[model samples]
Target: MKNVIVRGYDIPAKTMVIANIWAIMRDPGFWKDPEVFWPERFEDSDLQYKGHDFHYIPFLSGRRICPGMNLALPDGMKPEDVASSEAIGLLFHLKTPLQLKATPVF
Candidate 1:
């Protein structure tokens, strides 16, 4: 997320701040096997979607943190609000058994 804001009366030019969500998501220090999808990474942690932790900010940080939160009363439902609920719901409806097949060549 890249944002440009004009600051100072003398300098009307915009000041740009580039928020690197891709870099943050791929940081190996925070995410082991960063390229891989692993929900277990957050299993026993207190990290949240509010972006306070800095380790992860799927919903982003600061004043721009999701407008939908304002629509609903603050009952800690923002995480679900920004998540891919439709995709998850569709996956949940799969009746056939799903499987991943891989072979070790080594």
Candidate 2:
């Protein structure tokens, strides 16, 4: 019914659309200022990460669900230990400074 420009080329539009989730999530119709990283958006919302919500599907959904589901990683090391190790590793290996803020769970 219309022409959709893809990669600078005009393609004939059809009843169905084939688009990646990355593009769909950024669609203005679904989100306002989609380009901005607003973690607080989910702070007050009932948005889900367990594949039930469509607005935010971080781990994908259905057949393509993540294989690391229900994973319980070992906790032999403390949170600070892991954070320090990662920060130091990045500083040495990648020559980048890792910013980390420690906070109590309670």
Candidate 3:
């Protein structure tokens, strides 16, 4: 490993890199009304859901995409039926836990 420079900062060799995804996603400069739970902001976005863009990096992309990305709702549940309310703090929590029945698809 060798020294590297990023955006004018000199990073020592073999340094660990961590992305503050929460801050980046809520950056006012990159998003308008970022605190609001607005899904429509992406309606006109050209960015692919696969995290091709850094502005939004949900579970990353490509070979490093989250393993849980394949998780799906139980049968008979629509997206709109899911609760969207959130309680923000040091960590985000669902204002109300989602109520659902888990029925085996098999």
Candidate 4:
């Protein structure tokens, strides 16, 4: 890593650059009605969570991404079925506890 200029700003080497994912995801410039939970906005767009598109990075991007980044929904549940509630805290999280019932399959 070496010192480089980014967006006209000189960033020194080893300078930690933390991406404000929350703010970025909710930025009105990139998203319409960002504060509203509208999953359909991505239904027709080319946005991806693979970090290719900086606008949407749920599991993060690049080599440091989560191994289990590939995930699926439960058999009978739909995307809209999941309730979205933000808990009041420093970090982002759902206010309601997630309850899942697992059925063993042979």
Q: Best lDDT goes to which candidate?
A: 3
Which ranges of candidate 4 are over 4 A from the true structure? 58-106
Question: What would the C-alpha RMSD of candidate 3 be, to one decimal place?
Answer: 7.8
Candidate 2 clashes between residue pairs 3 or more apart in a chain or in different chains: none
Give lDDT tens digits, candidate 4, residues 1-106. Answer: 8999989999999999987788887778877887886655655767666646765554456886766435555678776878788888899899765556555656
If the candidates were sorted by their lDDT against the true structure, best first, what order would they fall in?
A: 3, 4, 2, 1
Query: Which is superior by lDDT, 3 or 4?
Result: 3
Error of 1 at 89 (Å): 18
Model 3 residue 81 lDDT score: 76
TM-score of 1: 0.38
Q: What TM-score, over all chains together, does every model reach?
A: 0.38, 0.39, 0.50, 0.51
Q: How close is candidate 2 to the true structure, as a TM-score?
A: 0.39
Error of 3 at 6 (Å): 1.9
lDDT of 3 by residue, 41-102 (tens): 66597876764576445445678776754566768877887888899899898886776554
Residue-level error in angstroms, candidate 3, position 75: 15
- For every candidate structure, what is the RMSD over all alpha carbons to the true structure, in angstroms? 15.4, 10.3, 7.8, 8.0
lDDT by residue (tens digit), candidate 2, 46-78: 766674787665446887876654443344544
